[model samples]
Target: MRVLIWILLILALAIGVSLLVGNNEGYVLIVRPPYRLELSLNLLLILVVLAFASLHLLLRFIHYARDLPANVRAYKENRRIRLGHASLLEALHALSQGRYQIAQKSASKALDLGEDPSLTALIAARASHKLKQKGQRDYYLAEAERLAPDAEVARLLLQAELLLDDRLYSQALDVLQQIEKIEHRFIPALRLELKVQLRLNNWEQVLVLLQQLEKHDGMESWQAREIRLQAHQHLIERHGHNLNTLMNYWKRVPAEDKLNTRIAKLAADAFIRLNAGNQAQEVLEMSLTREWDSELAAKLGDCASTNPQKQLQQAEHWLLSHEQDAKLLLALGKMCMRLELWGKAQSYLEASISVQPCAEAHLTLARLLDNRGETDAANRHYRLSVQACEDNK
Candidate 1:
């Protein structure tokens, strides 16, 4: 509708101009010696309008021509950016799909195209690592670090994780330490460090990491608890060779952990091995007071305390509440033997055999019988002990 109105307006203006020109009796004349020129004013006006329009068109063409090269360059740059972004996306998809080779290729292409070079390099590194191309992985990781030094944490985290997966725990630990220097409270880094420390048998560091993970909610409570238990157990074993070191380590153990049956049993056995029978007895008694365990009760029998009478009294006291517990009965038999109460030891050993018929109980009973000059009974019990051991196996 606007175009039709414009057309009518132009036609009307043309008609008005033609009428006015036809009515006008005006002309321009020029003479230069022998040459003379004459023209109507209306014709001159029309020529001037055409000249202005042509000049405007020429200027527009010149402006477009001057900018052509730069415009082309900008267009190519934009195209490269778009293509690089597409390649990056393809790399991510291929990586997620487990196509490591394709992902690495695409990410490398993206990196060459200069699209988020650091991110592309990291992606390529991950893919290379997955492909077990250690050389390429390290190269890409170095590129990532060099390209974006401000993202040191990211590069270090990836490097640590890859090293850990390769079971190069010491290398992973070094990388993790670098990350800690940059960002002390990174949860993922801490979790990775935990794994590295565990693999390295750095129980002390494992405990520290576990504490941080638990505090940050980076690990499940139960999972952290189990790891903590393992760390403490290993720490105990690590120091078990030296009596002073073992005692110092045990003293540093948290009171709550000391009551755990497994930890207590391990500590007790370690103490017994170091000839610290009193300490072993103390650990067992403390753990048993918290929670009863048959294995712990059985282990208690091996704690050869200096005060045999006192230890025997403790085992007998336990027997009052655990009359049917086979391990407790065995412990009582061993304790009675330690105190040289042969008749009581024989009764307790027999009772323990009646309850569970274990090889240890039978062997203890047979030893007691043999000491009393009952060769026939001792022989029969020895055969039963062997059979029991075979049955258990």
Candidate 2:
């Protein structure tokens, strides 16, 4: 279409020029100092048109020649980038399928092909690590760091992993700490830092890091609980005398979280360690009110009091509510015998055995009956304890 338009335009211009030339009745002359030249109007017009067209074509050729090198370089770079992309994708797929050797090969090829060498280096390092090629892993990691020095996150993460692999907890911690400083609140870095701290028995830092992790919606509740247990264990070891500090720690935890069976159980143990028998009793009582766990119920019975009568009475009350809880029944029976309530102890102990016959319950009953001088029944229970123990074995 465009060619046809150009042809039509040229024809119209030619006809216009022809009419102008034909209508011309006079000519013009050009003169120098001592010479003169004269030509037809058509000849001068043709010369001017040829000069303009030749000049335009020459300028266009100059421009095209100037851009050729840059366009070729761009094309080569683009091809290299595409090859790198393909190599990276292949490596990732291989890694997912557990083909560590193949993944390593592809990642290396990507780096060699002049792809984003830094990224390829990182991938190669990971693949090498999985393949257990320690030398290659270290070399690739070093290259990645050299290629992208400002990528502190990737460098520290790799270093942290290496230190962890070597069981160098302190070194890993140092690297992770530096990463945290460089990139505050980085979840991946913080997670590694948390694990290193745990290995170093640094519970205080574990608590703080866990709170930061909780801010990330990706963290699971179970993971948080595990961290809490570690933190609690550490606090108990370090601050056993400071009830106020421990209480404040508990207060900072969400109320619903405190209600977790694991946390509740931990809290009960903590209270018992503190020798706050009354508080432990209260906490366990409240816990048992909602959950009839045999383990918690047993612990609750033990935490009731030093006074055997009071302990026995509390256990019995719990038993009324949780009659099916054999552990609670055993605890109550054991306390009754401690208080010398022989008949009641026997009844409770026998009931525990009936509900869930175990060595523990049988042994308790045997001891209780022996204490009351009921020789025949005590002998029978002793035999039952031995039988139960053997069965479990």
On TM-score, the candidate that comes out on top is 1
Clashes of 2: 0
Model 1 residue runs over 4 Å out of place are: 1-78, 132-135, 165-171
Worst 10 residues of 1 by lDDT: 206-215
Highest-lDDT candidate: 1
Per-candidate TM-scores read 0.78, 0.69
lDDT of 1: 0.90
lDDT of model 2, residue 183: 83
lDDT of 2 by residue, 1-393 (tens): 999999999999989988988997665599996989898777777788999999999999999899989989999989988988899889889888989888889989988887676677877888888777889998998888787787768877977987887788988888888887898888888878788888888877888788888878537878887777767766655655667776777676666556666667777788778877666666676766777678877775456466656666666776677888888888787667657777887888788888999998888888877877889988998999999999999
After aligning candidate 2 to the native by TM-score, how far in Å is the CA of 271 from where it should be? 8.9
Predicted candidate 1 versus true structure: per-residue lDDT over 1-393, tens digit per residue = 999999999999999998998998888887897999898888888889999999999999999899999999999999999999999999999999999999999999999998897799999999999998999999998898788888888899999999899998888888888888888889999999888888888898788888788878999999988998889888888899999999999998879889999899889999999989999999999999999888999887899999988888888888888999999899888888888889998998899988889888888988999999999999999999999989988
